[model samples]
Target: MNNPEEKEITFVMPFGPQHPASGHFNAMITCAGENVVDLKAYPGYLHRGFEKLMEYRTHVQNTMLSDRVCILDPFSNEMAYVHAAEISSGVEAPERAKYIRAIMAELGRILSHLTWIGIMSSALGLESGAKIAWGDREKIIRLNEVITGGRLYPCYFMPGGVRDDITGDMAGEISRVLDTLEDKGKLYDDFVFFNTTFTTRTNGIGVINAEDAVALGATGPTLRATGMGSDVRKDEPYDAYPCVDLEIVTMEKGDAYSRSMVRRGEIAASISLIRQLLQKMPAGDFKVKWPMTKKVPPGETYFCCEAARGELCFHMVSDGTDKPYRVKIRGPSFSLALAVFPYLSRGVQIADIPAIYWSLDPCPADMDR
Candidate 1:
């Protein structure tokens, strides 16, 4: 029974505060019936006062703190903080240590990306893709745990270099894992990357132009997917990045598929970097002994590194105290999450919002940090 005098009303629908696809983030999306008209990102709850907490910890103690800021890509946070600390203290890591650090960071990238692939696929309803990605993720995690003491947040990185050294047959073990990863790459290429359903859902979806992406301060793969070749590794080399050769990966589509492809290409590229590192690694001390209680020189430094998600930077100010003066974390997801509104403008359907949101790959921990 329809009433002639009745009216249909359109209102804003909340997308999260508890979305299983991504983590803890919310979106208030206004829709005109089934078509999306506006989106407001409400990201937080993961802050935990990470920066303020870092100030109270000692120089070495904060490395563990940095890992919690962005759990998915712990090495990048470790690298950035270590770099800043080294610069402030006038210490340089040994060549062998640098190579090991780079190798580990690349491995961390692969691990994070695999997890991301599974999440993204699941968000798009591609169960097979998610299953394959998640299954392969275990192989990398096993290799990581064997090297670093911890399975997830390794805490293997120290101020001068790494906490420990890779000696004897460990390099060989790493190579064997790399070989296995290459074989699995073929499996993913066939089943996931080239799948028609994936292409249909991703290609041309959630498009971001190069100009807009730059203006919005998008970094890492988000900017690169728009055909920007900007990379912290290639642009400004730090750690072992100067020693190893890297080819920046980019895609012009500026869509979900392009971002996913950039990460996939980097996974392959990271494997090559790892092999190069093992071959070129010099024999030397793993770390320069620095007591955890030592205070850094009175100075400020900004260190940025390309993580699996994007450019992660840490701005640290040390007033010659064992405890830091002030620390600010610049996460890649902040700007990307804000830009969600522009991409969600009227043309997109209400059902497609999650797909588009997942495309930006915002990490609530990163954003809130």
Candidate 2:
């Protein structure tokens, strides 16, 4: 023991790679008693180096490889990669295909956000909320199976268009699932969002203003929670987004509660977008039909899409061959995990760490890739 006038001793603790609440990522947290003074993320437990792997695989194979980038969000990863390949090869997806892609992508957003809700709720000790969200998420995954013949890694998206088209019965099934999820949203509000315990833990915690959020490269719901209203879908429209009406949901507070609210509002918005897309879907070929060994022209292209997390971008260079010369991926979680988490974690209580960490909804696979 030292004199009372002496400086307080700080301790560093490793808070991940095994902690159920840590989400498979490690954080080296320096704390003075119960308060955190600093924290640094240590990712790469799930790294597959997907960018370099894509360079070795053929363009068609890369679509499957991209799914591993974010298994919880495989559709967005495949869509972004295929869009880059299509741009380099001068191929345009059909109008009907674009509508179908948009529908699937929005469904994918709902699926991913539901998973987030489950994981985040579980981290907060709200086991009932986790089960409710995950049960609803299963509906979307089953829909993926019906449409693409695969559950987790659908691999349905291709360079020019999707491998299959949505049938009339599939559309009805989708509508039914959407209706079920919309009805279940109220339970989430009652049991989780409006709970006194949750509000007490989240409100006024991990606050980051709009300017600081942008300066730190935050996006998607994280940035939107700060009232920035910046989204790739609105800033740079792609696929069926240009044709559909989208509302960029935002909240004035930049705390964990605000982030959760933004995503909750987005779930409703995505459901609305999908209904519109299905209504406007045209009758035509869903794909241009290219061979798996098709070669792209010598060109470099950068394509990005508004993934469930944020902006997921891919840069591709082709030397007039089936294999890409170079491929680089920019995932939103990199900044959110490595930069924003640490910035907001300072001066917060050790117990509040989980609330802040999961608020940004960082994916270990996205950051490690």
Against the hidden reference, what TM-scores do the models get? 0.95, 0.97
What C-alpha RMSD separates each model from the true structure?
Answer: 1.9, 1.7
**Per-residue lDDT of candidate 1, residues 1-369 (tens digit):** 789896665789888787684589887878778877777777776769889999999979999988887777888889999998899889998888899999999998998888888888888888888899888788777777888878778898999989988976878888998898888887887777888877888888888888988887888888899999999999888878888889899999898899889988989999999998888999979899889798788999998998887889999999998888999989888887866444544578877776777777778888887
lDDT of 1: 0.84
How close to the true structure is residue 60 of candidate 1, measured as C-alpha lDDT?
92
**Candidate 1 — number of clashing residue pairs?**
0
Local distance difference test, candidate 2: 0.91
Error of 1 at 286 (Å): 0.8
The numbered model that scores best in lDDT is 2
Top candidate by TM-score: 2
**What are the clashing pairs of model 2?**
none
Model 2: worst 10 consecutive residues (lDDT sum): 15-24
Cα lDDT tens digits, model 2, 1-369, are: 768898877999988988476767999999998999999889989888888988888988999999889988988999899899998988999999899988999999999999989988887888898999999999999999999999999999988899998986999999999999899888999888887767888999999998998888888899999998788888989888999999999999899999999989999999999999999999998999778889889989898898988889998899998999999998989889998999999999999999999989999989998
> How big is the positional error of residue 358 in model 2, measured in Å on the Cα after superposition?
0.3
